[model samples]
Target: MTRPGVSAFSVLGVCALIGLAGCFGPPAPAPTGTAAPTSTASPTASATSTASPTAPSSPSVAPTATATVPPPSSAPADPTPTGEPTFTGFPEQVARLTVYYVAIGDNGVSGPMIGCGDSLVATSTAPVRFTDQVGPSIGALLANKSRDVGLSGLVNALYQSDLTYLGGELAGSTITIYLSGQFMLGGVCDVPRAKAQLEYTAMAASGATSAEVFVNGRPIDEVLSLK
Candidate 1:
C-alpha cells in the first residue's frame, strides 16, 4: 500500500496558481469618461489677403478770355477863306484916308508931313473913277480948317495956275498924271515943294510908290528931285 510516493497536496497547489492567472489576464479596459488622445491634425489656419484704401482725383480748370480797346478820333481844322481884306476897329462902311500937311519950323523952313483922317466917301461895289473919289477927298482936306496944319490948298493952287489934273492912270507901282501943257512955276524951289505935296498926297491916297508927270501926253524928264 505505501509503495508509490505520489503527494496529493503538491498537485493541488499547482492547480490553484493556474486559476489565479486566468482571472487577472489582459489589461483592464480604459474608462469611458476619459477619451483616448486622438492625433487628428489641428485644422491648418487659412491665409486671408487684405486690400489698402485709395485717394480721390481733382477737377480740371479752364482758361479765361481778354478784351480789346479802340483808340480815340481827332478833331478837324478851322476853314477860313483867303484874300479878303481885314479891318480892325473900323465900321464896314468907313475907310481910312491919308492926307498931307506942311511941317513948319523957325524961319519959314517947310517940308511935307503926313496926316491920317477918316472920311465918309461914297463906296460902291461898281468900279469907281479915281478922279471922282480922290479929287473930292483932297478938296475936303483943303476946306477943313480944323484939320489943316499950315497946308494952304497947294493942289488947288495948281488948279488955279492952269495945271489941270486930267484923268490919271496907275500902272504897276508908278502913277501917271496928265496935264494940258508944260507949266512953269514961280521959281526952282517952288517946283520941288509943289511936286512933293502932290506926290505924297497922291501916294498916301492911292497906295502908289512913284509918280510921273506928263504934259500933252509926253513924259517930262526934268521936273523935281524926290529927296
Candidate 2:
C-alpha cells in the first residue's frame, strides 16, 4: 500500500540533503601564506605610529664671568720728629752752638709770655762768670739761654747753672715779648700766656751776637727782617 503524501522522488531528495549537510559540517582549510597570531610587536608598532614625538633636550647652561680684583697700592710712610732742631744766628765765638730757650712759670707751664707794645723781652742776671771779653760773656750767656730754654744734662751743666741762677736771682725780671704790631686780646676771656722763639744765623766769625731782635718797631727775641 502507498502512503497518502509520500512519493519515491521525495525520499530521494531527503537523502541528497543529508549528504550536503556532511559536506558543509567541517570548516575549509586556512590560506597557505598566513600564520597564527603571536604576542609580538604588531600591536605596539600600531600604537607607536599613532603617538606624538618627544620634545627636544634643552641646551647646557654656561658659567657666568667672575669679577677681577685689583692689587693693593703702596701707601706712603708717616712722618716723625727727628729731634734735631734748627738754630740760627750763632756768634763766631760759639760757631757751632745750637740754642733754644723757653720761659716757664710756677705752674710748670712754659710761658704766659707777654709782649711789649711790639716786642718781647727776657731778662736775667749774668749766670756765667766773665773774663771781660764780650765774646766769652756772650758765649756764656747764649749757652745759658740755650740750656734754660731747652737743653739739659751734665754736658749742659752751664745751662742748668744759668737756669738756677736766673731762677734764684732774676726770677723777678720782667720779660716782655714784642710783636711786629699791637695785638688785641679781643673780648674773649681766659687768655693766659704766649711764647716766642728766636733763631740766629751767622758766618762763624762774629765775636758776639745781640739777643735783641726787631719786629716792626718792636724788638723781639730775634729780629724779623726783610733783608
Candidate 3:
C-alpha cells in the first residue's frame, strides 16, 4: 500500500523539471517595434609597479709625472803660473881692447909736447878679462910705451912713468880711467898738454868725446886746476 501511493517528493521533482524546462527553453520572439538586450561583461582593474631613484656616479682623476736631475763633474786643476819669465846674464857678452898713442911734436908757438895730431897712431884688439879691472893686455902696453919700436918721438901722455891702469869704463859720452898711483908733471905747461893728450887718447880708444881721470880713487880735478 505504501509503495503504490504518490509521494510529495516525486510531485515536487516534476514541478522543478517543468520550471527548468521553461528556463532552458528557446528564446521568446522579440516584441514588435522593440530591440533585444545586448550581453554586457564586467570591467576589471590592473595592477601598476613603481621604480626607485639611484645616486649619480663620481668623475675619474689622472696621475702627475716627475723629472730627474743629473750629477756634477770632477777634474784636475791647472798647474802653471801666469807671468813673465826671468833671465840672468851680462848686458854685453863679448869685449875687446883698442890702444891709442900720442906723438911728441913741436907746437907752432910752444916747445915740444905730446898730442894725438888729430889722428890715432895704432889700434890693437885683445881679449879682455871678465873681471872689474881693466884688461891686462891693454894696461901692459900702455905702461910700457918705451918698448914700442915705432913710437920714437911719441910719448905716452897717460903714463905716469910709475902708475898703472886699474880700470876703465865708458859712461855715456865720457871715458873714466882709474889709476893705481899719483900723476906727475914738470910744469904748468904740462896741464893743458896732459889734458889734451888724455882726452884725445880716451876718445880714440872708446869712441867718447870727454875723459875723466882718477888716481888712487881721488878725482884728478880735486888736486889740479884743469880749467
Best by TM-score: 3
Ranking by TM-score: 3, 1, 2
Question: Per-residue lDDT of 109-205 in model 1, one digit per residue for the tens?
Answer: 3333322211111211223233334443344433333423333422322322345556566688877666564444444444544455556555655
TM-score of each: 0.35, 0.17, 0.40
Model 3 residue 37 lDDT score = 36
- Counting clashing residue pairs in each candidate, in order, gives 0, 21, 0
Candidate 3's residue-wise lDDT over 80-184, tens digit each? 776987755334434565454444344422322343222224445456644332344336445653533253454445454456677788789998887665556
- The whole-model C-alpha lDDT of candidate 2 against the native structure comes to 0.34
Off by over 4 Å in 2: 1-32, 35-41, 57-143, 146-222
Query: Pairs clashing in candidate 3?
Result: none
Candidate 3 at 83: error in angstroms?
13
Which 10-residue window in model 1 sums to the lowest lDDT? Answer: 116-125
In model 3, the worst 10-residue window by lDDT is: 41-50
Candidate 3 to truth, TM: 0.40
